[model samples]
Target: MQLEKDSKLELNDRSRQIGDVITDVESKVRKKYETHFQEQEDKIAELQRQLNLVSARSRRPKRGRKGKEV
Candidate 1:
Protein backbone atom coordinates (compact mmCIF):
# COMPACT_ATOMS: atom_id res chain seq x y z
CA MET A 1 0.00 0.00 0.00
CA GLN A 2 2.84 2.45 0.80
CA LEU A 3 4.54 1.67 -2.52
CA GLU A 4 1.33 2.46 -4.39
CA LYS A 5 1.05 5.80 -2.60
CA ASP A 6 4.63 6.78 -3.47
CA SER A 7 4.09 5.91 -7.13
CA LYS A 8 1.00 8.12 -7.26
CA LEU A 9 2.91 11.06 -5.73
CA GLU A 10 5.68 10.75 -8.30
CA LEU A 11 3.22 10.75 -11.16
CA ASN A 12 1.51 13.86 -9.85
CA ASP A 13 4.83 15.71 -9.55
CA ARG A 14 5.79 14.93 -13.16
CA SER A 15 2.41 16.02 -14.42
CA ARG A 16 2.71 19.36 -12.63
CA GLN A 17 6.16 19.97 -14.13
CA ILE A 18 4.90 19.33 -17.66
CA GLY A 19 2.00 21.68 -17.14
CA ASP A 20 4.33 24.47 -16.02
CA VAL A 21 6.55 24.05 -19.04
CA ILE A 22 3.59 24.18 -21.39
CA THR A 23 2.37 27.41 -19.81
CA ASP A 24 5.75 29.08 -20.17
CA VAL A 25 6.06 28.11 -23.83
CA GLU A 26 2.57 29.41 -24.60
CA SER A 27 3.32 32.79 -23.05
CA LYS A 28 6.52 33.19 -25.10
CA VAL A 29 4.74 32.31 -28.33
CA ARG A 30 1.99 34.83 -27.68
CA LYS A 31 4.52 37.62 -27.05
CA LYS A 32 6.39 36.86 -30.27
CA TYR A 33 3.20 36.91 -32.36
CA GLU A 34 2.11 40.21 -30.83
CA THR A 35 5.44 41.82 -31.69
CA HIS A 36 5.26 40.55 -35.27
CA PHE A 37 1.75 41.92 -35.72
CA GLN A 38 2.76 45.35 -34.44
CA GLU A 39 5.67 45.52 -36.87
CA GLN A 40 3.41 44.74 -39.81
CA GLU A 41 0.93 47.39 -38.69
CA ASP A 42 3.66 50.03 -38.51
CA LYS A 43 4.87 49.17 -42.01
CA ILE A 44 1.35 49.49 -43.43
CA ALA A 45 0.89 52.90 -41.80
CA GLU A 46 4.15 54.19 -43.31
CA LEU A 47 3.21 53.00 -46.78
CA GLN A 48 -0.19 54.72 -46.55
CA ARG A 49 1.44 58.00 -45.55
CA GLN A 50 3.73 57.83 -48.55
CA LEU A 51 0.84 57.11 -50.88
CA ASN A 52 -1.11 60.13 -49.62
CA LEU A 53 1.86 62.43 -50.10
CA VAL A 54 2.38 61.26 -53.69
CA SER A 55 -1.31 61.63 -54.55
CA ALA A 56 -1.47 65.18 -53.24
CA ARG A 57 1.56 66.23 -55.31
CA SER A 58 0.17 64.83 -58.56
CA ARG A 59 -3.09 66.85 -58.71
CA ARG A 60 -3.67 69.16 -61.68
CA PRO A 61 -4.94 72.74 -61.38
CA LYS A 62 -8.05 73.95 -63.29
CA ARG A 63 -7.96 77.15 -65.33
CA GLY A 64 -10.87 79.64 -65.51
CA ARG A 65 -12.34 80.27 -69.01
CA LYS A 66 -12.55 83.87 -70.39
CA GLY A 67 -16.06 85.42 -70.37
CA LYS A 68 -17.73 86.06 -73.77
CA GLU A 69 -18.66 89.71 -74.65
CA VAL A 70 -22.44 90.44 -74.86
Candidate 2:
Protein backbone atom coordinates (compact mmCIF):
# COMPACT_ATOMS: atom_id res chain seq x y z
CA MET A 1 0.00 0.00 0.00
CA GLN A 2 2.83 2.40 0.82
CA LEU A 3 4.56 1.62 -2.50
CA GLU A 4 1.38 2.35 -4.37
CA LYS A 5 1.00 5.72 -2.64
CA ASP A 6 4.58 6.67 -3.44
CA SER A 7 4.08 5.81 -7.08
CA LYS A 8 0.99 7.94 -7.27
CA LEU A 9 2.84 10.90 -5.79
CA GLU A 10 5.64 10.63 -8.32
CA LEU A 11 3.16 10.48 -11.19
CA ASN A 12 1.46 13.61 -9.95
CA ASP A 13 4.76 15.49 -9.76
CA ARG A 14 5.68 14.54 -13.31
CA SER A 15 2.25 15.66 -14.54
CA ARG A 16 2.67 19.02 -12.88
CA GLN A 17 6.08 19.47 -14.42
CA ILE A 18 4.76 18.72 -17.89
CA GLY A 19 1.96 21.24 -17.44
CA ASP A 20 4.43 23.95 -16.39
CA VAL A 21 6.56 23.35 -19.46
CA ILE A 22 3.52 23.57 -21.72
CA THR A 23 2.47 26.87 -20.14
CA ASP A 24 5.93 28.38 -20.63
CA VAL A 25 6.00 27.38 -24.30
CA GLU A 26 2.54 28.86 -24.88
CA SER A 27 3.54 32.18 -23.33
CA LYS A 28 6.64 32.44 -25.52
CA VAL A 29 4.66 31.71 -28.69
CA ARG A 30 2.03 34.32 -27.85
CA LYS A 31 4.69 36.98 -27.31
CA LYS A 32 6.40 36.18 -30.60
CA TYR A 33 3.17 36.46 -32.59
CA GLU A 34 2.26 39.73 -30.90
CA THR A 35 5.60 41.22 -31.84
CA HIS A 36 5.31 40.02 -35.43
CA PHE A 37 1.86 41.56 -35.82
CA GLN A 38 3.00 44.91 -34.45
CA GLU A 39 5.84 45.01 -36.98
CA GLN A 40 3.45 44.26 -39.82
CA GLU A 41 1.10 47.03 -38.72
CA ASP A 42 3.93 49.54 -38.64
CA LYS A 43 5.00 48.59 -42.15
CA ILE A 44 1.45 48.97 -43.48
CA ALA A 45 1.10 52.43 -41.92
CA GLU A 46 4.35 53.61 -43.50
CA LEU A 47 3.31 52.33 -46.92
CA GLN A 48 -0.02 54.11 -46.64
CA ARG A 49 1.66 57.41 -45.78
CA GLN A 50 4.00 57.11 -48.80
CA LEU A 51 1.10 56.34 -51.12
CA ASN A 52 -0.82 59.39 -49.92
CA LEU A 53 2.14 61.66 -50.59
CA VAL A 54 2.59 60.27 -54.11
CA SER A 55 -1.13 60.66 -54.87
CA ALA A 56 -1.15 64.28 -53.74
CA ARG A 57 1.81 65.11 -55.94
CA SER A 58 0.24 63.42 -58.97
CA ARG A 59 -2.99 65.43 -58.58
CA ARG A 60 -1.24 68.77 -58.84
CA PRO A 61 -1.67 70.66 -62.15
CA LYS A 62 1.35 71.00 -64.49
CA ARG A 63 2.53 74.39 -65.82
CA GLY A 64 2.02 75.14 -69.54
CA ARG A 65 4.62 76.67 -71.95
CA LYS A 66 3.85 80.25 -70.72
CA GLY A 67 3.98 79.16 -67.05
CA LYS A 68 0.17 79.01 -66.84
CA GLU A 69 -1.71 76.06 -65.34
CA VAL A 70 -2.14 73.34 -67.98
The top-ranked prediction according to lDDT is: 2
Best by TM-score: 2
Q: Report backbone clashes per prediction.
A: 0, 0
Give the whole-model CA lDDT for all candidates, comma-separated: 0.76, 0.83
The digit string of per-residue lDDT tens for model 2 on 1-70 reads: 0123345567777677678778888999999999999999999999999999999999999889999998
The 10-residue segment with the lowest total lDDT in model 1: 1-10
Q: Which ranges in model 2 have alpha carbons more than 4 Å from their true place?
A: 1-9, 64-67
Q: Residues 1-70, candidate 1: write the lDDT tens digits.
A: 0123345567777677678778888999999999999999999999999999988876744445665432
Clashing pairs in 1: none
The runs of at least 3 residues in candidate 1 whose Cα sits more than 4 Å from the true structure, single-residue gaps closed, are: 1-9, 60-70
